[model samples]
Target chain A: MYFGGSFSRGDFLFLLSGAVTTLSITLVAVVIGTVLGVLFGLIRAGAPWWIGNTLGAVLDVFRSVPLLIQLVLFNSFNSMLKLNWPTFTVGCICLGIYASAFCTEIVRSGVGAVPQTTRRAARSLGLTWRQELTSITLPIATRIVFPSWIGLTLGVMKDTALVLWIGIVELLRSSQIVTSRVQEPLLILGITGLIYFVMSFPIARLGNQLEKKWGTQ
Target chain B: MDYEFQWRPVLRSLPEMLWGALQTIEIAGLAMMLGTVLAIFLALAKRSGKKYLSLPADMWIETARNTPALFQIYMLYFGLGSLGLQVGSYTALLLGITFNNAGYLAETFRGGFAAVPETQTRAARSLGLGAVQTQWHIVIPQMLRAVFHAMTNQMVWSVLMSSLGVIVGLTTDLTGVTQKLNVVTYRTFEYFFVAACLYYLISKAFTLSARVVAWRLFRY
Candidate 1:
């Protein structure tokens, strides 16, 4: 009613629910992605040259290619194979792997970024290799890579908008539905963008702050 | 044993896909060029120490860095269309990506510029170089090297971003053409799979070419 041409409060609620769905997808994907990434990254670091490079190349395809393409391809595959999973599940599967691909790189570089001398020092000090990793390399890498991980989480949140293509009505799609019915693309899209900005701004600011603070120390 | 993929239709459309990819590459390349140019100014403005100048730059950077690129493109195409603006789909996508690139590269440039020691600029000036020459001959080379990794990431990102053209009614980009083929042939997996490989190759080509260019030009 305030700035309206028949966009009801119910429409706004619908959008809010869509935002919730986006958050849910992001949360689950981040967890799954992080775990897979950590595991693969560790394996890649110690892996033989041929295996590591091949794995890296395969993962690179996921990272370099567009997520939109992956979504469409996978969704189609799902139907073709009669997997018949819901769109949400399919989205999560693709996004989880997508996040894992990038996360693996982050972890690899982070592990490499650990000073070799420090790792050697730890190894020389009567600690096992496992102890050296846990006590020395990993902690430092985790701290160093923490900011980027946050950035990745925020990225997954934004990428969730693409799921609309597969027919899951997250935030952007909700706005699309509203606009189609109510005929106010700018107003609705602006509101949707604002919602995204609000959700992301604080986290992004935190990432920047950490990058500075942790980077210096 | 499952849903058979009909690749014949997809194979027949290779020329169309190639043309669409050419368009996508053209937009991404232009956006990167323009975005880098704009980012230089924004980076300067942010460090210019004037609130009036930096405030607007800060807002542009923050809004762009925080929002999803899809919505930005959507607004440019659909949102503006509603207002009778009627921007072309290709142009709108280009503008949106350029806007994002400028905002992101501005931040990267700011850091890269800071990495260049202040003494170097003074040294260039003392050697009788003009302001423009100092920036071009001295500052930019070092800054580009410092930020080279980030620059390549954005270059690859621009290619990845071209896929968003589908939602914006772009029929000429690789993804757009693929989506059109998808709707008609219902060979969703086959078409998108080919499109995906094309995208992978294009993005790989960009990164690999960038590496070769850097190797040829950059030195220790």
Candidate 2:
């Protein structure tokens, strides 16, 4: 009724549900991306030269290419090989893997940003390499990288909109569907953009605050 | 045992893919150029220390930074069309990317400007240099040097985001062209794989050129 048409309460609910779906996809992908990224970061940061270099090269490919292209190619490869996975599942996996590339770099650089003297100081205290990393280096590095990690979280939340291309009915696609039905693209898309802005503003604000508080450390 | 990799289709489609790559570069280059100009103004607005100017710039930066590039492009392409403000896919995509780029680069430049202490500005004023003169002669060169790496990253991001043009009916970019070839040949893997390689090469080229430019500009 707001735009001189029958914009029902159900339409709002539909978009809300779509927002829930977007959050779910972002949550699932972030969890998977974090785990894979941590593993890759550890390897790239501390593993043997050959192992680290090989993993680095693979991650470089993923990071360099566009996520949209990766999603399309992965979806096609899955169907071509008769994998027949659901679109949502394929989207989650592709997005998780795509995000893992950036996360790996963030983690690697975070760890590198930790001072070498700190590591050596821990070692001279008779700490093992594992203890030196977990108790000393990683804690400091994680603190340093917290702002970047939050930035990445906001990024993944936004990138979830791309899953619409593969027919997953997330928030952006939900708006698109409504736009098609109601013939009010501007109103629908504006509301959708506002929804996204609402979803992301708090996280970005928190990132800024954290950077302000801990960045000087 | 029967699945053989064919380079013939890839070779046959090389010219088309190359043309597509050129289009990709063209759009990204133009968007970056436009974005940088807008970013300068936005950054200056944010630094202007007045509520009216800063507030709108802040909203634009925050909104553009928060939303996905795809959403921004979709609004411009589909949403604007339905509003009867139709534009070509190329213009829609270009405007969308430039908007996002301006938001991001404004933040980067703002940070760079902040890193230059207020003491320098006061000193410039004491030396009878006007505000614009101080900014141009002292702050901007240093800020550009500080943000050269960030600008390169944004360039890569612009190139990658251009791939989304395929979804918006852009058939002239690399991804768009690759999608067309894939439909004709049913060589989805080969075509997309080659396209990915082309993207990788483009990014690497940008990285290398960025380093060279940084060296030349910041040799001091």
Candidate 3:
């Protein structure tokens, strides 16, 4: 019944804090996911048959399953393993693992898009496998996959919300807490949606711009 | 640290789990159907020369596209509940799926519509067809051809997003059943493995069917 009370000072701080937490988790997860994605992408792209297939299977299992279930499993597994990890750390790890699957696909596609001639030419120039990958293949592949990478990043940002189910005090969780305290659901939810909109809009806009630019190139 | 892995409890839950899988498919199918219609309308409206109509349609599409489906469901289910306008979890789930699907489908259809040649629309108009007639006879058919693959991608997304319904208390879906079984048996690996298999099978079926439709419709 406290309609106007939800807009009070403390509730705003609480929601803002939640937004910050969500952003921090997403940022850390994206960085780790991108690194893992690149490694997995290399395995999928240029590794030997057994290695590539093994990595491919790992990516497939992660991608095919729902994030909620993955989050739950990892949270429990962390406890069973007695890792003493914080829930936020576990949330970040789960999100990173999930994001890496999609990123690996994007990165692998990017790497594959690099013409075979480039690799052959690099080899003819006496480049080592590591040198060829770092100097030639990865650069060209990154250009090709830039748009998809951006799109996946946006997806990862939005997915940070899923951690709320595991008791992470993300934006959605904050809104729930505020609703309980002040009992103004519409305003709180509306504000939460707006906050999410703010966080997501720039990334999506950047994704579109990159796609358009890269499409022309 | 040696805990016995039991298959008996998971096996006992198979029938109910299968039932939940069916419900997940049913919900995804219905949502996709409804959302496609909404997408067509939004796509066409956005393409209409009228600025007012296109502007709001653009805003709706952008908003829905930018946010996560989980947030939308949470907003509809819990957010609306806070306003004293409680909706059934299933209804809220459907609304969320439909909303997300519509946004994605609008983009897909819009891309398809863009792929259609302007000359085709002009030719239809020159033949004395009205705007509506031009859209139906000249634009839609060609657009559908271009959108076939994109539509299949959206269907995959819808199937995946349907898993979020479990969070809002809609427990009659595959993810929900998996979660419940996981809780009871602590058989994480088995439950998630089975759920992933179900998702892959369903998505593969959709992909195959879509390919067939694409072949038939756009065969030269």
Top-scoring candidate (lDDT): 1
TM-score of 3: 0.91
Across B7-64, the per-residue lDDT of candidate 2 in tens digits comes to 8989998999999999999998899999998998899999999999999999889988
What DockQ, between 0 and 1, does each candidate earn? Answer: 0.79, 0.66, 0.52
> Over the stretch A103-164, how does candidate 1's per-residue lDDT look in tens digits?
99889989989988999888889899889988888999999999999999999999998999
Total clashes for model 1: 0
Which whole-number lDDT from 0 to 100 does residue B35 have in model 2?
95
Q: What tens-digit string does per-residue lDDT give for candidate 3 at A1-217?
A: 4344537888888999999998899899999899999988888888898999998987877766668778877876776677869999999999998889989989999988899998999999999998998899988888888878888888888888889878899988888888887777778888888998998888778878888888787
- Structure candidate 1, residue pairs in collision: none
lDDT for model 3, please: 0.85
- The TM-scores, one per candidate, come to 0.95, 0.94, 0.91
**What is candidate 3's TM-score for chain B alone?**
0.92
Candidate 2 per-residue C-alpha lDDT over A1-217 given as tens digits, one digit per residue, 9 for 90 to 100: 4444556687778888999999999999998899999889988998899999999999888878988888888998787778889999999999899888888988999999988888899999999998998899889989988899889888999999989988899999998777766778788888889898899998899999999999775
- Winner by TM-score between candidate 2 and candidate 1: 1
Fnat of each prediction, in sequence: 0.88, 0.73, 0.49
Clashes within 3 Å, all models in order: 0, 0, 0
